[model samples]
Target: MSKKILVWFRNDLRLHDNEMLVEAIAKSDEILPVYCFDPRQFELTNYHSIKTGAKRAQFLVESVAALRQSLQSYGGDILILNGKPEELLPALVSEHEIAEVYHHREVASEETAISTQIEDLLWKQKVNLKHFIGHTLYNKEDLPFPIKDIPDVFTQFKKKTERDAIVKPCFLTPDAISFVTVQDWGILPELSELVVNEDIEGLSQDSEFKGGEEEALNHLHDFLHTGEGMALANASLKKNEIVSKLSPWLALGCLSPREVYWKMKEAEANYGLKPYFNQIVLGLLWRDYYRFMFKKYRNTFFKPEGFKQELALVPLADSELLHSWKTGNTGHLLVDAMMQELNATGYINTAARQLVATYLVYELKVNWVMGAAYFEEKLIDYCPASNWGNWATVAGVGNDQRLTSSFDFQKQLKIVDPKGAYAQAARA
Candidate 1:
């Protein structure tokens, strides 16, 4: 009998640079790609925030649809299922006679929990669930230090890793996939079918975060091959012109960091663009550091006090202050405008995010976890490692607490939105 494999799609949604997809095709005579739209993801959190907000839900729907279309073009298709992976994968495994399952590894507690459950159940059926580390720019094993010994400070980690480590080339996109033909692959749901399509005029109507691999590649292409990214490469441009908001796609694994890195190098070689490219490269490194830190420290990043020390700068609770901050009535024009932008568009540039998040922690003296949770609910680009890790760092209890924690919001606001142009856009 031919060795059949079931490839489980988690966040690493795209075919390009997807390790599991490449592995499944190579090792198995027949392959089936499956993505589960878990109801748990759409449920509410303890903080009363929708676990996956509508904008994010919509983006996911579009991404999955695009993936299916991409797969079809390659003589394959992804099984679009609407249930928990733990409940659904076992049945698929047995029904399809799958010998093994492949998926990308995750670091966060809840995601890991599901992975563990699926592994245990698969083991009971005499099948193995294999994990590949494809999320980071540098593979986990390629880091200069092990997860436990990575530097507590970002600069230290970055310097050491830059000096010693190397980013492996991305896995090539498969030209064709040999698929196990199933009678039904199921229907992809519309955004409204997945989440309540709210009349959320509060979120940014102008923000365009298109989902899926094609759009992601388009964004990267425009950034490098076209003028938007190249214009920022000018040595004289202010940092404000460099709004590389690729996080939404990166967060969902629609685009791989290594792909971005190599492409930036390609752009440099072709255009001799200035090294503002390194700024974005450093951002990729930061994302890797957070994921590695999450793997090292785990749930401590989620706690109010954090794992380092009791960082009780203020009481961790919801109050009128938090309400004002959330509603964009905080009375600080810069902070209010940034918050308004985040609410309206499901995104804010890096400066805006730092200013507003820092304001919530130090200036308003509100609970940082609540602020992070709000970001989790609102950001279309929300990733567990980056979101909570950033919050803990800003709250001064993360791995780099020894480093300076807060930013000069006023100074930053004047630079990024000096004329209050973004503020006017948010308020208008």
Candidate 2:
């Protein structure tokens, strides 16, 4: 009898450098990969009005569909389920006589809770559960500083690890799985199946990228190997230009950071090194830092006080102002444009995220937690730690060096987004 292994597919979507998939293939005679489209994700939120909005939901469905195709090409299959993993996984395990469950470790309240319950149940079944860290370039064990004692500020954290940190190289995937067997499968739920909002929406014409590992790899090549790659990097480094545009892919686990980092390094070798490596690497580091923060702080990072307790409370913005911000009717062109982009495409550049978050907390006097929740629902790369930590830091609540301040919308419009191109484009 072949030893059955269940690969619990979560954010780490791709086949390449997929630690969990690689390990599962090695350990099991037959591999069964499963992706659960948890229904709760599409429900409405109290603050944002809509939970998973149309654009993001559409992108997620598309990405999962792409993943299914990719797995089929490699002589395997992704069993699609449309319920909570805790409720679904045990039944599948018993039916398959699964020997093990292999999955990537996630660091969020809800995600961890599900993982914990699954782990406990598997233990009772005598099924071995293995978890690998495939999400970030720097593994938790590989970090120079203990996660518990990580620096409070980005500068200190970066300075200590910049020279000492060694990013583990990527591992090549096996050519193919020996056997392909799926007992039963079902269709993915439509947008209306999970979402309550009656309005059906498509990606706004501005969205240039699609969800999938294929598009992600193509983007890496375009960003790193091609002529446009160097240009985008150059422009983005100088002023946060249309560089790479890989955040959504990176966020969705369509592309691994290791894959991107390797490609970027190779591009540097081919095109000659530039000063922007530091800036680009810093963004990658931000991703790593958030993961670390999440593991260390757990659900506390989701709250207003974050890691620090005893912080003074400020009056939060009422629902009226938050609605204005979410609807892109705040009258601040740059802020409005950024929110509109997020609403239409499920993404915003790092620069835009920082500026808009600052505006919400300091200028509008809105709670940063609300902004974080809105991002959580809409963003393609909504890692809990990164999203909440970044917002809290910007809101003067998290590990921050800069004083609590607000950006002047008019000044930001003239400077960061001169000529009102972004504003005009989003408004249109």
Candidate 3:
């Protein structure tokens, strides 16, 4: 009997450095590529905001569309479906007589729960569910400490990991994937189909960023080596100019962290490890730190009071305040401008994110989870670990060692966006 495998595309969307896809191609005689648009993700959040807002939904659509085209070019086609994975996978397994299922392991609580459910369903059918770590820069096993032993503070984790850990080389992209026949290649849903309020004015479609493996690789090349490199190198010295806008592609898994790391190393070699270059590497380290922290603390990372923290009696989740912040009508110029940028483009620099989040949590006294959820909906670059963990920290509920923390909005504006270039552009 011929062996067949179902390669489930989750957050790890690209063909390059996709360990699970590479492994499946090696082990199976035929491959069934599948991507499911989970309805649950499109539903409204507790804060009365769509869990996946227009900007993100549109980006996801573009990403998946790009994935489908790439797969087609390789003699394989992705079965893009609009349904729950647990419901869809079993049917695909039985119909195709799939010997096994292969996918990247997700670390967040909800994602892990869904994976567990699918594993259980697949087990009853006697099909093996294989998982690989594809999201992080360093493999979990390569880390010096176990997940439980990952430090509470990022500095400690970064120091230890940077000193000892190794980032494994990325898996090679398969030259060709053996295609399996399927009658229905489900239609890829548009923003109108997935989101109810699709006609959101000012929610511009022509974002500076476009999603896909092609765009990602191109951006990586230009940012690291070309004229774009000179621009970034020049901008790195200034606080106002962002060094790279690679987070959206990173969040969608269109670009792997390892790929980015290796490219940065090459740039460092050519340009002699500038502080700005190191800063980019530090950002990637911070990403790894958050994922490891998420792995250790699990669902507690999302709670108002995070792990090892005392539960507070303070009422979090003030809906009215949250709405004001989300809509960019907070009456604070910088905060409102930042919020507007986020709402319109689904892209904001790290500094702007911190400013608005601090304003919402500290100044307005709104619930941090509300702010996080709003970002989850709005941010094109939203990763569960980075988004929630950062929110918890800012809310005085997560990994911060400080007793209290808040960003001064005026001070921040003066330092980062002085003369209001960013604010003015955002408002316009």
How big is the positional error of residue 69 in model 1, measured in Å on the Cα after superposition?
0.4
Superpose all Cα atoms of candidate 2 onto the true structure and report the RMSD in Å to 1 decimal.
Answer: 2.7
Whole-structure CA lDDT of model 1: 0.84
What Cα-based lDDT does every candidate model obtain? 0.84, 0.76, 0.83
Which model scores highest in lDDT?
Answer: 1
Q: For model 3, how does the per-residue alpha-carbon lDDT over 130-231 read when each residue is reduced to its tens digit?
A: 989888888899999999888887778889998999888878888978988988888898677888555655566677788899989999888777765665
Clashing pairs in 3: none
Per-candidate TM-scores read: 0.94, 0.91, 0.94
lDDT per residue for candidate 2 within 215-239, as digits (tens), equals 8898778667666556644564352
Better of 2 and 3 by lDDT: 3
By TM-score, is 2 or 3 better? Answer: 3
Candidate 1, residues 315-372, lDDT tens digits: the string is 6566888999987998877688778777777888777777788888778888788888
Over all chains combined, what TM-score does candidate 1 have?
Answer: 0.94
- Give each prediction's root-mean-square deviation over alpha carbons: 2.3, 2.7, 2.2
